[model samples]
Target: MSHLRIVRDEPPKRRERRPHVNHVLTHAEQAQARAALKGLRNAFGSWSALAAAMDVRITTLMAAARGAYNVSAALLVRASRASGLSIGDLLGKPIAADRCRACGQIKRRVA
Candidate 1:
């Protein structure tokens, strides 16, 4: 009797898209988040220090970064001011999230 060996030959699964939470930040927003995080770190001199200054738990900041949630406008403004980026530059043009991202048509939200 010969022993048979079974091997599973399957490629690793790749997710197409990851849905964001209540606030869906665009890809650009994600990039901005990275810059903002860097600014935040630089302003406070370190991640641990920033957390202390902001009175937020360090884990919260880490989670926000891991999840790719863009900092809120208020946070962005504060970070921009701290990091030497003008508010105008940080905001750029107003980008509304109320439009259908695929076609840019306005859509009403369900109540």
Candidate 2:
């Protein structure tokens, strides 16, 4: 009788992963986003109207207004356009230095 030999393949090595980072909005930013959405809702006089204006579902707008979920950047841009406010204002940041000339600090460019 002859003894049988078996060959097995080695397992692949695992890759290293970097530590996770928390990118969720802070409490204050969440509140600001919620307030901005709510104000838009109020302006439109109904959730459905606001949703139509934003082209999002009424439930989504409601949840965002109630702070049930983090408001996305695209949603914020829609709100900004409908409200005539800049994205910076929606995010509670001052407008970019170049676009804001009302402060009288930015000099006019000579063309």
TM-score of each predicted structure versus truth: 0.42, 0.58
Off by over 4 Å in 2: 1-24, 93-111
The local distance difference test score of model 2 is 0.73
The most accurate candidate by TM-score is: 2
**All models, RMSD in angstroms:** 15.7, 11.2
| Model 2 lDDT per residue over 1-111, tens place | 999977669766789998754356677777787877876676678889888888899998899889776787678888888767786677674333334424636546689
Clashes of each: 0, 0
What residue pairs are clashing in model 2?
A: none
Candidate 1's clash total is: 0
Model 1: per-residue Cα lDDT at residue 24: 45
Task: Give residue 59's error in model 2 in angstroms.
Answer: 0.3
lDDT, candidate 1, 1-111, per-residue tens: 999978779966888896755364567775666555655575567878866665556776666656544555555554555546565554444334354434668878689
The candidate that wins on lDDT is 2
